[model samples]
Target: MTKSVGALTVRTDPTLKEVVVDGKDMSVYVFAKDTKPGVSSCDGECATQWPPVPAADAEAAKGLNQELLGSITRADGTAQLTLAGKPLYYFAKDTMPGDVKGQGVNDTWYASAPDGWKAGVKRQALGVLDHPKLGKILQDKNGRTLYLFTKDEPWR
Candidate 1:
C-alpha cells in the first residue's frame, strides 16, 4: 500500500522505496524513456546492458491515478509504462539507490518526465544506444546505426 502527502503521493513497490537525495524525499519511479516514437531505439549486445524495464505484473498497477499512468506498445509487442503519456524506464547501470548515472546519457537515454530522477540527481543513462531506431541516431561501431534480431518464432 502507498501513502500520500498532500497532492504528492509516494509510489511504493517491493522493489522501489523512498530515499533522500539532496535532503528531499522523492519517490523513485521505474519505467522506460522514448528515443523518439513508435519504433523502439535499442538493440544488439547493447540491449544486454540497458535491457528495457518491463512492468512486473501489468495488472498490478491498476486504478491509482489512472489518469497519470498508462503504457505504449513497443515494436517487440512489449508494453512500456507511460506517465502523463510519456514512457518511463530505469538504467541497468544504476546499481544502487540515489545513483542517477544515466541522466542525459549519450543524448539518448533520459529520465522520464514528471516521475523520474529528482533534482540533484546524477545519471549516466547509456541505454538509448540499444533501442532500435524510431528516427535515427548516428552510426555506432561496425558502421551500424540501428539493428534488431528477430527471435525464432514461437518467438521468445
Candidate 2:
C-alpha cells in the first residue's frame, strides 16, 4: 500500500492524545459525506482542500491496531487508507506538522483520535463538581453541560 500519509502514528496533544502522520503534527480527519466505513466522498475540489490519507501496504506504527488499518479505492482510482471505516485526510490549510486548522469545518469534518474516533467530540470528565445537597456532579471536560442524574438517583 504505498501511502502518502506514511506510517500512522499516535501523538498525544497536551490536552488530548490523537493520531497523526508519521512525522507531521497535522491530525487526520474523516469526511461526513463518506458513505460508509473505509469509503471516501472527498474527491476533486473537495480532495484538494482535504487531502485523503494515502494507504501503504506497510504495517502501521507499533502499538497501533493493525485491524483498524485498511485501504479503499477512491474515485480517482487511487487507494486511500481508512481508520476504523473512516477515510483519513489532512486539511489543506494546515501548513505545519502540528497544525490542526481543520479540526471542525462546516460541522462536517473532525480530527481523528488515537482510537480512530472524531477527536474533539468524545466525552471527557473535566472534574468533580461538589453539590452541597446532591453530592458530586459530573461535567464535561470541555465545559459542555452534561446531565448526570435526578433526585431519585436515575440517570438523566
Per-prediction tally of clashes: 20, 7
lDDT of each: 0.40, 0.67
- With candidate 2 superimposed using the best TM-score fit, by how many Å does residue 95's alpha carbon deviate from the native? 0.9
Q: State the displacement of the C-alpha of residue 67, model 1, in Å, after optimal TM-score superposition.
A: 1.6
lDDT of 2: 0.67
lDDT of 2 by residue, 1-156 (tens): 443555667776665456455544467787767866446877888988998877765346854566667778987788787766667888889887877778779988887764455666755556443332354556566433368445665554
Candidates in order, TM-scores: namely 0.43, 0.69
In model 2, what is the error at residue 141, expressed in angstroms?
13
lDDT of 1 by residue, 1-156 (tens): 212211223333232232212112222233243435443456455445555444333321222333444556766677655444445445667766456566556655544323332323343432122222232333333223345657645644
Candidate 1: residue 17 lDDT (0-100): 34
Model 1 regions lying over 4 Å from their true place: 1-39, 56-65, 115-156
